[model samples]
Structure formats: C-alpha cells, structure tokens
Target: MDMLLGVVVMLVKMAVVLGVALGLAAYMILLERKLLGRFQVRYGPNRVGYFGLLQPLADGLKMLLKEDIIPDGVDRRIFLVAPAVVAGTALAAFAVVPFGDGLTLFGHRVPQVVVDSNVGLLLVLALSSLAVYGLALGAWTSDNKYSLLGGIRGAAQMISYELALGLSLVPVVMHARSLSLSDIVAAQAGLPFALLEPVAFVIFIIGSLAETKRVPFDLPEAENELQAGFHTEYSGMRFALFFVGEYVNMVLLGAVTAIFFLGGWHGPFLPPIVWLALKVLAVPVFLIWTRASLPRLRYDQLMALGWKVLIPLALLNILVTGALLAAGV
Candidate 1:
C-alpha cells in the first residue's frame, strides 16, 4: 500500500509541476512583451484584456487554432519531434527544483520538490545540454539556408558557452559539498554561494545569457541576419512549441540561478514559495531589460567572449576556490 501511495503522490506532483511550467510559459510571453514595450516607451497588449492580462490566453488559443505547415523536402519526423524535445527537456529540468520548505498536511510531511535526487544539479545541466539538439535538428531538417546557418551557429554557441556554464557551478558544489539542489539550498541557510564566489556567480549569469541565446548573445537567431534563425521554417503549433521552449528555458535559468546563488526560498518574513517566485520573476525581467539595452554582438565577439573570457574566468574561480578550501578559508 505504501508503494501505491507513493506512486499516486508522485503522479500528483508531476501533474502540478507540469501544469505550473506550461502555465508560466504561456504567461511569460505576455510578461516579456509587456516589459519590452515599457522599456521601449509604449503600451503593450493592453487591448486583449484589462491591463493585457488575457493576452496570453488569446495567443494560446490562436496557436492551437492555426494550421501547422510542413515545408517540402524536410524530414517530417524530426521536424515534428524537435520542438517536443526542446519543450520536454525544459519542463523536465524543473523536477528537482525546490520552491519551498516541506509542509505537513493530514499528518504527513511532504517536500516541496518533485524529486530530491542526489544528482539533481547534474541532471539539470545534462537536460539543458540536451535541449540544444532540438534547435539543431529542427534547423537541419527544415532544409532552409537560413535555418541551416542558424543550426550551425546555435550548436557552436551553446557548446562553447556550456563549458563555462558547467564550470561556473564547480564553486557551488565545492561550497555546498553536495550535488543535490535541496542540499545546496540548505547549505545556504546562513550565506549564499553568490557572496562566497562572486566570480562564479558573474560567470554563471553571463554563460546563462549565452546558453539561453538572449540579447547580446543571441547571434543564432539574429532576426536582421538569419531571419528568425532555427525556427524560421516552423509554423503554427510547431512554432508555438519552440516559443514555449525558449520561455521555459528562461524560467529554468532563473530558478537554477536562484537555487545556486541567491539562496532558494531563503528570504525572511514572506513565505518561502513567494520568495522563490519573486526571484524567478526577477531573472526573466532582467533578461528582457538586457534585450532592450544591449545590441547583438558580432558572431566572432560572441564566440570569443564565451571561450576566452567566461571559460578562463570560471577556471580561475575554481582554482581560487580550491585553494581557499585547502587553506581552511
């Protein structure tokens, strides 16, 4: 009976987490548009509903009702599968993210996390790395020159930045002494890793910007050059899936940043869940602000920044952290 009960609970948690991820993804588009407009001195989507609150619902409905088109000579199977791969990986990575302290209901205590796996941090990195395949495959299968270039750029950029992104986490693991995200959060009860390892914190944020292909790092999908980049050939629901993948990735980066650096759900006074939600929302807004503020870098500059700057900085941080640990600092 305990086994059955556990299975049921897991299902419930999965359902809730998925619902939240998709729901937030749909609304994140609205939030980004709204914020981007404000940053550019304009009103955004205020017509769809009061204060534009119903815009996401309208947009989702439109996507569901649109016709899905397949370009000629494309690999139909991969074309269809790619977006799912991207969206699925983004949603799945949230499994190990803890949002609040455990709570007791009906005499049973339950963790706020979906899966408190010991290797949750590693799982997140692996899944993030996997998401790029969707971009590459979708672009390649589209058989469009624009998309093909996008695929090449996307793959190279992500692969290059991923090294720094992964390396930046070494200090977090060193400080926390655990790979589990929950354990890492608990380790920050007194002080967050961001304060302890600012170098890694900065490197992680910059690497994350590149990883998500945001703003200055968004060379793969440079609209002026690549004409919608990897998803240029995608239409209707397929395009919507890619859109979901990007927004969900933004949320994932925000959550991971909070969990590893800002002390996940660690603020005082407010509820833990509220604290996490605020932090999660903050990162996306910052990304939008960046999109408004920065110009896209030249492709060479993007590659050089990731490989020459972030990678070296992350390695130096790891060495310094190791030395500090050895010196009992």
Candidate 2:
C-alpha cells in the first residue's frame, strides 16, 4: 500500500503539472496574439470570445478537428514521431521544476515537484539537447529543401547555445553547491543569484532565448527565407504540436530562470506559488515583445554571437566565479 500510495501521488503531481503547463500554453497562444496585435497596432482575436478569452479553446478544437497531412516521399515512421519528440521533451523537463513548497493533503506531505531528482539540472539540459533530434529528423525526412535548410539552421543554433547555457549555470551550481533545483532555491533564501551573478544571469537569459528559437535568434524558422523553416511540410495536429512545444519551452525556460537566478517561489506579500506563476508568465510575454520588436539575425551573426561572444563570456564568468569562491568573496 505504501508503494501504491507513492505511485498515486506521483500521478497526481504529473496530472497537475501537465494540466497547468499545457493549459497555460494553450492560453499563451491567445495572449501572444492579443499582445502582438496590440504591439502591431491592430485587433486580435476579439471576435472569438470576450476579449478573445475563449480563443485558445477554439484553437484547440480547430487543431483537433483538422486533417493530419503526411507529405509525399517523407519517412512515414520518423516523420510521425518527430512532433511528439518535440512536445514530449518540452513537457517532460518540467517534472523536476518545483512550483512551490510542499503541501499536506489527506495526512500526506507532497512535494511541489513531480520528481525532485538529484540531477535535475542535467536532465533538463539533456532533454533540451534531445529536442534537436525532432527538428533534424523532421526536416531531413521532409524531402523539401527549405525544410532541410531550416532543420540545419535550427540544429546548429540550438547546439551552439547549449554550451553557453550550461556554462552560465555553472556559477549558480558552484554557489548553490548542488545540482538539485530545490537545493538551488534554498540556497537563495538570503538573496537571488541574479543580483550576485549578473553576467551569468544575462548570459543565461540570452542563451535561453536562443535555445527556444525566439527572435532575434529565430533564424531556424525564418519564414521569409525558408518558408516555415523545419515545419514547412507539417500540417494539422503534427504542426500544432511543434507550435505547442515552442510555447511550453518558453514556460520551461521561465521557470528555470526563476529557479536559477530570480529565486524560485521566493517573495513577500504573496504565496510562493503566486510568485512562481508571475515569473513564469513574465518570460513568454517578454519573448513575445521581443518578437514584435527585433528582427531575425543572420545565420552567420547568430553563430558568431553564440560561439565567439556568449560562450567565451560564459567561460570568463565561470572563471571569475571560481576565483571569488577560492578567495571566499
């Protein structure tokens, strides 16, 4: 019965996380459209519902009702699987992200996270890196030159930024002295890492934007140059999954940024969960604002920024952090 209770708790944790994450992601679409519409000085989906509130539900229904189209000459098996790979990795990484402190229900104490793994940070990085497989495989198998180019760009950009993203977090890990995210949060009780490691905070935020393919790093999906980039051949629900994956990734990065730098679930005058929700909500809105404001970078410029600038800066920050630690600073 003990084992069964554990399983039940785990399931409940997963269900809550998924429901919130995916449900928020769905509404995020409506929010982005509304924000972007306002940004561009136009109306959004106000026709759908009151101030477009019901748009996400309508969009979800449309996607579900749409026909699934598989392009000719594509690898049917892998092509079918790629979108799931993208969406699954984006969602699965949230398992280790703690939303708030523990809560007691029915005489049981439940942790806020779905699974508080010791190697959570590493797992998130690994899962993020694995998302490239979906992009690459989907593009390569599409038998479309435009899709192929988009895939290549997407794969290269993500891999390039991954290095900097990892290095930027190294100082946080060193200061926190644990790879567990919960421990990282606890270590920040006195002060947030963002105030202490400003450089790493900037690098991590910038690297995260690149990691999620948001502008001005959205060269991978440059519509003007290579159609819709890697997902050109995808239609209906398959295409929708890729769209969903991007928003979820934005939320994932926001949560991570909060945990790593902004002090996860820590604030005054509100609940811990509310603090977390505010941070998570802020990130994608920022990303959307950026999308409206910034132009896509050239491929060469993108590569140079990641390789020549961010990575080296991240390394320098890590070195400085190491020296400070050695000096007890």
Candidate 3:
C-alpha cells in the first residue's frame, strides 16, 4: 500500500508538471512574439483574441488541423519518430527538478520533485545529450541537403557547448559536494553559486543559449542560409512538436539555472514555490531580450566561441575552484 501510494503520488506530480510545462511552452511563444514586437516598435499578434491571448490556442488548432507532409523519398519511420524524441527528452529533464521545499499533506511528507535521485544532474545532462540524436536522425532521414547541413551544424554546436555546459556546473558540484540538485540549492543558502562562481554562471548561460539554439548561436536554423534548418521538411503537428520542444528546452534550462546558480526556491518575503516560479520565468525573459538585442553569429564564429573560448574558460574555472576548495575557501 505504501509503494502503491508513492506510485500514485509520482504519477500525479508527473501529470501536473507535464500540463504546466506544455502550457508554459505554448504561452511563452505568445509572450516572445508580443515582446519582440514591442522591442521592434510594432504590434504583434493582436488578431485572434483580445490582446492575442488566444493566439497560442489558435496556432495549436491550426497545427492540429493542418496536413502533416512526409516528403517523398524520405525515411518515414525515423522522420515520424524524431520530433517525439526531441519533445520527450526535453520534458523528461524536468522530472528531477525541485520546484519547492517538501510539503506535508495528510500526515505524509512529499518531495516537490517527481524524482529525487542523487544523480539528478547527470540525468539532465544525459537527456540533453540524447536530444541531439533526434536532430541528427531527423535531418538525415529528411534527405534534404539543407536539413542535413543544419543537423550537422546543430550537432557539432551542441556537442561543443555541452562540454562547457557540463564543466561549468562542476564548480557548483565541487562546492556543494554532491551531484544532487537539491543539495546544490541548499548549499547556496548563504550565497548563491552565481556570486561565488561568476565565470561558471556566465559560461553556463552562454552554453545554455547555444543548447537552445537561440539567437547569436542559432546557425543551425539560419533561415537565410539553411531555409528552415533541421526541421525544414516538417509541417503541421510534427513541426509544432519541434517548435514546442525548443520552448520547453528553454524553460527546463531556465529552471536548472535557477536551481544551480540563483538559489532555487530561496528568497525572502515570498513562498518557496513562488520564488522558484519567478526565477524560472525571469530566465526566458532574459533569453527573449537577448534574442532581440543580438544578431545571430556566423557558423564559424559560433563554433569558435563555444570550443575556443567557453570551453577553455570553463576548464580554467574548474581548476581555480579546485584550488580554492583545497585552500579551504
């Protein structure tokens, strides 16, 4: 009965998280378009509903109703499965993220996370790495040279940045002495990791932007160059899946950043959950601002920044952190 109850609670948590995540991913698109319009001094998406509040709904409906075109002479099975892989991996990374402190309900204590594994960071990194497979396979199967080029660029960029991204967190883990994200958050009670390890924070932010394929690092989807990038051939709901996955990845990376650097669920004069939510929301806004302000980097520049600059800096940061820890700082 205890095990069964635990299973039920986990299921409930998963459902709630999935619903909120998907909803946020949809609405974030609306928010980005609206804000981008304001940034560029134009009105954006005010047609479907009042202030375009229903734009996401309308867009979703259109995707559902539109024809899903699997292009001729393509590998059908992998093409169909690729988007799901991307979306699923992105969503799954959230399972171990702690949104708040534990709660007491019906004389039982429940963790805020769906899965509280000790290696939660590893799980997230692994899932992120797996997302590349979908991109690569999708592009290869599409049989389009443009898509193939985009996929190659994406895979290379992500792989390069992943080194910096993973290494950037090592300082935090070293300070916290645990791979568990919750422990890392708790370690920041006195001072958030961002204050202690600003270099890591910067590297993580840059790497994260690359991971999400946002502006300045979005060579993979360079519309001027690759038409539509890896998902160029996809249409309808399949296209929507890739689109939604990007936003969801943004949200996930934001939460991870909040947890690891900004002190997750640790703020004064606000409930822990609310604090977490606000921090999570702030990241996407920053990302949008960046997209508005910065132009995309050339593919060579993108790769050079990740491999030559970010990765080296991340390694240096790790060494400095190790030295500090050895000195008992």
Candidate 4:
C-alpha cells in the first residue's frame, strides 16, 4: 500500500511539475519578446489580450493549427521524433530539482522535488548531454546543408562548454560534500556557494547560456548565417517544440543555478516556493539583458572562449577549492 501510495504521489507530482513547466515556457516567450522590445525602444505584442498577455496562447494555437511541412528528401521517422526528444529531455532534467523544502498536507510528508536521488547532479548532466542527440539527429535527417552545419556547430559548442559547466560545479559539490541537490541546498543554509566560489558561478552561467544556445553563444542557430540553423527545416508544431524546449531549458538552467549558488528556496520573509521562483526568474532576465547588449561572437572566438578561457579557469577553481579544503579552510 505504501508503495502504491508512493507511485500515485509521484504521478501527481510529475503532472504538476510538467504542467507548470510547459505553462511557464509558453509565457516566457511573451516575456522575452516584451523585454526585448523594451530594450530596443518599442512595444511588443499588445493586441490579442491585455498587454498581449494571451499572445503565447495565440501563438500556441497557431502552431497547433498550422500544416506540419516535411521537406522533400528528409528521413521521416527521425524527423518526427527529434523535437520530442529535445522537449522530453529538457523536461526530464527537472525531475531532480527541488523547488522548495518538504511540506506536510493531510498528515502526509512529501518532498518538494519529483525525485530526490543521491546522484541527482549526475542525472542532470547526463540528460543535458543527451539533448545534443536530438539536435544532431534532427539536422542530419533533414538532409539540408545549413541544418547539418548548424547541428555540427551546436554539438561542438555544447561539448566544449559542457566541460566548463561540469567543472564549475565541482567547488559546489566539494563544499556541500554531497551530489544530491537537496543536500546541496541544505548545505547553503548559512552561506551560499556563490560567495565561496564566484568564479565557478560565472563559468557555470556562461556555460549554461551556451548550452541553451542563447545569443553571444548562439552560433548554432545563427539565423543570419545558417538561416535558422538546425531547426531550419522544421515547421508547425514540430518547430514550436524546439522553441519551447529552449525556453524550458532556460528555466531549468536558472533553477539549477539558483540551487547551486543562490541558496535555493532559502531566503527570509517570503515563502520558500516564492523565493525559488524569484531566483529562477532573475536568471532568464539577466540572460535576456545579455542578449540585448552583447553581439554574437565569431565562431572561432566562441570556441576559444569556451576551451581556452572557461575550461582552464574552471580547472583552476577546482584546484584552489581542493587546496583550501586540504588546508581545512
């Protein structure tokens, strides 16, 4: 009975998390467009609903209703499955993310996260790595040279930055002395890892932006050059899935950053869930600000920054952290 109850609870949590994630992803598009417009001195979508609040809904409806076009010579089966792979993997990464502390309701205790695995960090990294497969497969199967080039660039960029991303978190893991994200959050009750490992924090942020293919690290989807990049051949809802996956990834990365460095759900005065939400929201805003201000780097410059700069700095951070630990600091 206890096992059955646990299964039911898990299903409920999964439903809630997925619903909230997808909803937030849809609205985040609206938010990004509005913010970008404001940054560029213009008004964004304000037609459909009050201040264009229903713009995402209208956009989603349009995608659902549009004809899904499969380019001639494309591999149909792989093409059909690619967007699902991207969207699914992005959503799955949230399983181990703790949004708040445990809560009790009706005399039942429940964890705030979907899965509180001891190796949650490893699972996150693994899922993130798998996302590249979707991009590569989609681009290759499309049989378009532009798509192929974009996919190759994306795969190379992600692989290069992933080293820095993983290494950047080493200090956090070492400081927390646990791979479990919940324990890591708990460890920051007094002081967040950001204060102790600011270098890692910066590296992780840059790496995450690259991972999500945001501007300045968005060479893969350089619309001006590659003509929409890897997903150039995608249309209708299939295209929408890729777009949604990016926003979902942005939110997840923000949440991960918050959990790792900003003391997840640990702020005073406000509710824990509210604190977590604010922290998560702050990251995407910063990312949008960056997108508005920074020019996309040249491909060579991008690769150099990731490999020559971020990786070496992350390694140095790990070494320094280790030395400090060894010295009992």
Candidate 3 lDDT, 61-91, residue by residue in tens: 9999999999999989999999999999999
TM-score for each prediction? 0.98, 0.98, 0.98, 0.98
**Where does the lowest 10-residue lDDT sum fall in candidate 1?**
99-108
Model 4 spans with C-alpha error above 4 angstroms: none
Worst 10 residues of 3 by lDDT: 98-107
Candidate 2, position 132, lDDT? 93
Error of 4 at 306 (Å): 0.9
User: By summed lDDT, which 10 consecutive residues of candidate 2 come out lowest?
Assistant: 100-109
Clashing pairs in 3: none
Which digits, one per residue and each the tens of the lDDT, describe model 1 over residues 140-210? 99999999999899999999999999999999999899999999999998998889889999999998999
Clashing pairs in 2: none
| Candidate 2, residue 189: how far the Cα is off, in Å | 0.8
Q: Rate the local accuracy (lDDT) of all candidates.
A: 0.91, 0.92, 0.93, 0.94
lDDT of 4 by residue, 125-219 (tens): 99998999999999999999999999999999999999899999999999999999999999999998889899999999999999999989999
Model 2: per-residue Cα lDDT over 273-300, one tens digit each: 8988898888889999999998888899
Which segments of model 2 are wrong by more than 4 Å?
none
Error of 4 at 131 (Å): 0.6
